[model samples]
Target: MPPTPPSTPARDEARIRDRGDACPGALRLHAADDGGLARLRLPAGRLTAHQVEALAVAAETLGDGRISLTSRGNAELRGLAEECGAELAALLAEAGLLPSPTHERVRNIVASPAAGLDGLGGPEVQLWARELDALLCAEPWAAALSGRFLFVLDDGRADVAGLGGDVTLVAVRPGAGQEPAARQESAAGQDPTAGRLHVGGRAWLVAGADAPRAALAAAGAFLDAARAAGNGAWRVRELPEGSTPDVAGALDRAGIAAEPVPPAESLLVHAPPLAPGPLGTASFHVLAPLGRLTAAQLRALLPAEEVRLTPWRGAVVVGAAPGHQDHARLAALDSHGLITRPDSPWAGVSACTGRPGCAKSRADVRADAAPGSARGLPVHYSGCERRCGHPHGTWVDVVATADGAYLVDGAPTPRTALPDAVTTARTGAIARAATPSTPAETTR
Candidate 1:
């Protein structure tokens, strides 16, 4: 009813690519409307307070005094000087952020931020995140992957399963635990590491596919598919049906057994979105009004050892205790304007940079996208039709069409009707969010 939870559906064929992936990296910068931009990859978005502080200092001293969170769970430093690559590189290198130069861009990985801390999702996926990352960086051939290539390690909670990943591995469990009704028939067995594998258009029931093996096999499968396609396919979803990697064969070749999931019973995989606020009493998840965070906001997270940046423009602040977060420290974050409670409307808002930051933008979306007014669903304000950072699942899409008039998910609406439409959409999404059958639906 509420845009029935998504499945791992076959996507439309992608066009061939002739050039390199222009995605920015810590050393390689992109010239944007504002200035040079550098992206730092954080596998699973795991970062220590020291690492976070290092990034904050670099942003304040070398860039625009701001650090932006990305949908890939990465970090970006913009407004950089033309010749600051050397300084930026040196700083990041010392902080151990750049593990490998050749594979930095290809290190696009996202996992459940609350994997273990939330105590609901299966398998502590951050463990797999590191092992897989190490394997990727060590394999020279992996460097050939396009910067846009992505891998998802969902913790069976569905938080990041539907970010349209090139390769996805999700934990399998039974009973009702945040899964949509559509998923009941296809729910796999209870295996912390073993789960269904989605590589491009095909699905496989993998055996012995732990994080390390699954990650390696997925990468190998893509390489085989890409080579067979020979059309510059950068992602598994890009290859035609003929070129869809024989994931089963790849796993077998890797000594990882995998059987074809019956097409009818393959996992439905509903990826619900994670709400911003304290997450399940184990940790405090907070978000900025917008995706961008100034150095001061980042500093506010300090004295806290580790943090995980989510694709949804927020973070999970874990506690030193066995299964709880430090309330006082979380309160400090709340003081700094982070949305630590679900009731705060800032939890439901996001906007892409417009105006001075993006030349193609027709409107300054960030200027108009204010938060703190509670909404049931997420609202994304886009400068143009591209909708660069909209929610992955159901949401209220506010796209700019003119000075005041706009489109709500493509239908034209008067400026006056915008709020009502958004409210209606949010109401539906809120109902879905509260439904026990829903799953997490964060973006890529």
Candidate 2:
């Protein structure tokens, strides 16, 4: 039997928001200590070569000379002049990056980075992502969605199905028989290309062709629930207790046939991010060190037809040059300081904008957490208690302290011994629960 959907926290335990989300966007830049910060959402993380060039140009000309990748497969440009918003918007509009200003921030979508390239996955879900993006921008109500709202399209590989999306659609391969319960409501007949739509803890089986619309309808239902709850909830997961979205009703109202199904364990499995290196004969995957890409490093990925950013803060150069040319391109990227191999010391290490970039940072965590040999587990360095940009799932948490020392999974370690401590913690040499010196705080 399928497992019961987990229950949400009680009402008293729910976090009630008091204000609107302040997520920065291309047009709505956030004032940061570094300067104006703008986040550009890349649905399906798709970017043409020209678009890449445009981003490189924008990073060099308008903001910082570096581009930071967000965990959600988005790009961020920091240290911008406040008045450069218009110029930045114009530049993005020219590159076809900004389809609609109203829907720009709400266009958070992540898809399988290796889809259509590697033969392991089902169908090309990126096509669905593109269609859903167009549908989202055209709909007036979609703009009400919080910038944090996410849509994950897993192309049967289960790579991105666990990224905590508000609405997740995983393609089902042909001949993969459905559960008997799901088959009972197939009045519209079974589709050869079927997909599962998951919202909160509920799941539904819908035709692959109708998955996009069904996903959108699910989001609308969440918005309705959010409104009724009268709490400033940003994500479907943040809705009040007992407020699970009525996805089946929404899909029915949209004239799309769907079958209520048990949430699949495979969808929520913690799949590691795509490894960095050659993905296929025609594609190369690489990661930006510390999730920050200099203009030179970003350009090194160019001369390709297309690039798809991954949720793990990496990019896949698709349709790469053939034969010996591909080898040369890979070498160029490695020389430019991009992580071209999975075994690199920087592979599982990430840090937030510490010290000078963030006023809350007590130490320069990035400088201190420089590259070293690969550890057994992922490690993240946070400048403050609010660990921004930390990796999901099990990881070694390293936070800077107020006393000029550092915490390796809550164990106090002097600055001089930080490297060894971090390595030891990542290797799980000493298994202990993290006990931060300061009270735990949420990321801004």
lDDT of 1: 0.71
Among these predictions, the greatest TM-score belongs to: 2
Give RMSD to native, each candidate.
5.7, 4.6
lDDT of 1 by residue, 1-444 (tens): 433222332435555667766767888888878999888899998888889889999999999998888777888888999999999988998888999999998889899888876677754567778888999999998898987788888887777888777788776554444333334233333443455677655666553245467667778878877887777777776676677676667667777655566566555476556776565555667886688888999877665548888898887766532344466666777888787777776776887666678776777778766442375667787777556656666666677776666666556766667667666666653443311110111112
TM-score of 2: 0.91
Candidate 1: C-alpha RMSD after superposition: 5.7
What lDDT, from 0 to 1, does candidate 2 have?
0.80
Task: Residues 321-345, candidate 2: write the lDDT tens digits.
Answer: 6756777787888888988888888
Tell me the deviation in Å of residue 148 in model 2: 0.9
Global lDDT of each candidate? 0.71, 0.80
Regions of candidate 2 where Cα sits further than 4 Å from its true position: 1-12, 176-191, 263-267, 371-373, 429-444
The alpha-carbon lDDT assigned to residue 318 of candidate 2 equals 90
